[model samples]
Target: MYAAGLLNYSEHPMKVIIDTDAGVDDAVALFLALAAHKDPKCPFEIIGITCVLGNTGVDNVCRNVFTVLDSTGVSNIPVFRGADTPLVQPFIRGESPFFGVDGFGGVHSLPNIPVVKQERTLEKESAPLALVRLAREFQGELTVVALGPCTNLGIAINIDPNFVKNVKELYIMGGNSHGVGNIRPCVEFNFFVDPESAFVVLSAAWNQKIVMVPLETCKLAMSSMEWRKQVLGTIKSSCSISLKKGLLQRFEKDYGSWCSCDAVCMAVLLKPSIISKSSTNYCTVELQGAHTRGQVVVDHPQKTGKPHNVTIIEQIQLAELERMLLSTFHPSTFI
Candidate 1:
């Protein structure tokens, strides 16, 4: 079900700026956002996309974004190039093997690809500067959807401390919980790649209306391969043949189910009701520890005097999310 107040904002779709590192999951999130933008029922308008370093380098991110934009026929949404590495750490590369050689699950080389790149010159802007500018322009209205390392956001906050206070909210796809990890034994990939930046961004202020989608929640909320097959199989009329083919290939390679870590965060923003359970907590990233570095620590007030800074989504309404995903990615969908 859609959020109660979504329709009320139809006259002015909620303006959003997506900050991502453009990996396979990030690519799916981008496409989901594009699909949502086309839905009159979902109040979201992607104002711009900013790239940072996480899954791949900034250069590859830019190229991948351009390729998606061309394929989806989404025009005029400017994409900015941001930080190439974490704030205080050396650039970490070659970590995620699931995304394969291209960080896109190796689908770019598939035979008879229907999505063609549009011939156009690309101009770029600094990601942090773009963040600052867009925040000022849409003060109290802009919502930032962060899908990668927090470098770009931390830099923006450093440049302008009020950047966080000025924005509407931040929907972030990172961190881990329940003692699970994708990179190290205790850290998610995004936070592990740039823990310093995550620390800076997460601990910047006492209260900032941030919603975190961690690894454990993603693992349990929507991990059914049968559900994926049912949804993808029935959506042939809604998705382009190329995208459908690509997604099927991705599912096949993964042995059916895909967790959708990043895309699920995007889904929450469009329909807040997708979350069946959650908690507000004082959250911060661990900067030091031989085995626990990059782990996001959520402490209770009794343990720490600090107030809660984030709303940790511990669970989600999976069936509702599946419905939302189906509607958002249907091929007839246009942005």
Candidate 2:
């Protein structure tokens, strides 16, 4: 049974900006965002998408972002390519053998949507400058859904210490509280890949809201064959077909469950009450550990007596998740 509290945010949707790396999971998250945008009850509007480097190269991620948008028949969402690598470090290629050469599991066939060149003027602006401009323009109304390394966000905060105060909140898909890491035994991929950026963002003094979806919570929200079939069944456009085929093939090959880690993050932004959250006394990123570099060190026991900097999601209701997904897939049946 779904918890009553989990269904709380159905009354209103939030304005959001998705910063992603365009992984398969990221694609799922994007779909959830689009679905929310389509819902009349949900007032969420995806202002734009900012691409980063993590699951794949910046170019591949940019392509995947546009491809996913095209497949969903969504246009007019401007995408900006952020930093090509982490702040102050060279780009180290990850083991894509797990996620396919291209982040979307090597889905070759794509929609015939014209490859719209990125708005060069937007590209010319530094990521920090662009973020500041956007925040100022949408002051106190934009929520940033960060689904990858926090490089651009950190830079933005550094550029303008008041940057966080100007926005609504930041929904981040990263960190691991239980010591289980996807990239390393103790380090989650997103934090490990760019500890510096993560540190800067997390430590910033932001009155803006913060919701963190850790690995522990995300692992429990795994995808199954039934879910994949449901998602594929909803495809009526050629772009959707290409994405569905590629996604299915990847899952069949034993790559990974099309887990919606990023999607869950987006879901929380749309409906914050869907998951149970806990307040950590304080949290810091481990950057120099021998085997635990990039691990999110939460002060669970309040040993430091420091003020809380982030709101960590410790548990989520599965029934509520299923309900949300079903409603997103079939909007008319939701009411």
Candidate 3:
């Protein structure tokens, strides 16, 4: 029955809005989203791409978004520049040594595509506002896929108490289960980079569905040299070409193969059944603590008595995940 349930969820695709920092894996996630949008079998439509500051500065992230869209030949999907810094912490300006200087390893030049301007007169709202507006417009019909710090989404929830209720589901790529951390012994990069924003977003009262791609499981899904060769070797799109020659080359030289955080996030969006052993827990971010700051403090023992806001994904079937990842790049096999 468990195996059958996973198979069932993999068959349906959901509507998604990807909020990212445009890191190397974020680029791969964007490619996956674009691929799903183009596939007739998968009915996922990328409503928009919002840039945030995590892997790089906000300006560079915005530029990277445009570059990826241009390379993928997708101009209709709007890209919005989000918050430049965290709500409480000082803006830490650091480039991702792992992802290369220009985020996408300078594989493809920054596209000359024109930035999308907002026509609505609400003081030309930021990315968070755009997200709130879209949530209201497509209430209960959209899924929020967050691949970076939760600054924008948290701001949106603060703007309206019922802000997140409009969305059907929320998929977040942060937090660490099993008491392990990627950035530190207790914190992951995404949540640690902006703990205040993460706290606000996770504390919201909306009862909508939530799926968290914890670092515990995501770390296990790392990309191998063989997988990169398979994706770059088989796909023939313009995006794939640049990803193969440029991004993959730098990735192999630097990090061996990309970590699968963003890719697993995209896969979860496409097929939720890839998840197993999810538990409802009350999670909050620790802004204090010198070494443990930005850590996701999960109340598994009901210490807080607060309602569970996060569904922590604990296990994933490796065989099925591998199959899905391979199938995503194969043109003959859709969904």
List ranges where model 3 is wrong by over 4 Å: 1-13, 94-96, 109-125, 229-236, 241-258, 330-335
Give the candidate order by descending lDDT: 1, 2, 3
Give the higher-TM-score candidate: 1 or 3: 1
lDDT of 2: 0.72
Question: Which candidate leads in TM-score?
Answer: 1
* Selected candidate, larger TM-score, 1 vs 2: 1
State the lDDT at 71 in candidate 2: 54
Q: How far does residue 6 in candidate 3 sit from its true spot (Å)?
A: 16
**Order of candidates by TM-score, top first?**
1, 2, 3
lDDT of 3 by residue, 1-335 (tens): 12111223344556668899887778767766776676655567888778898887777788777766665555667778888788887756454455666566666543442323333211245788889888888887888899999888888888877677887888899988666786678788889888888888777766564678888877676667776676445554445423445556655775576555787877777767777657878887777889888888888789898888888777666666666555444433222
Per-residue lDDT over 197-272 for candidate 2, one digit per residue giving the tens place of the 0 to 100 score: 9988888877643678998888787666666566634534333423455456645555355456787887777777
> How well does candidate 1 score on lDDT at residue 290?
89
For residues 1-335, write the lDDT of model 1, one tens digit per residue: 23222322224458999999887778767877877675556667899999898778888777777777776777778889899878886964665455655566555533443565567444566999999989989998998999999999989999998888778888899997555787787889888888888898888762365899998888766556666667544554312332434555555664456667887887777767678888888888889888888999878534997777888888887776666566555655543
| Clash tally, candidates in order | 3, 0, 1
Best by lDDT: 1
Return the TM-score for candidate 3, rounded to 2 decimals: 0.83
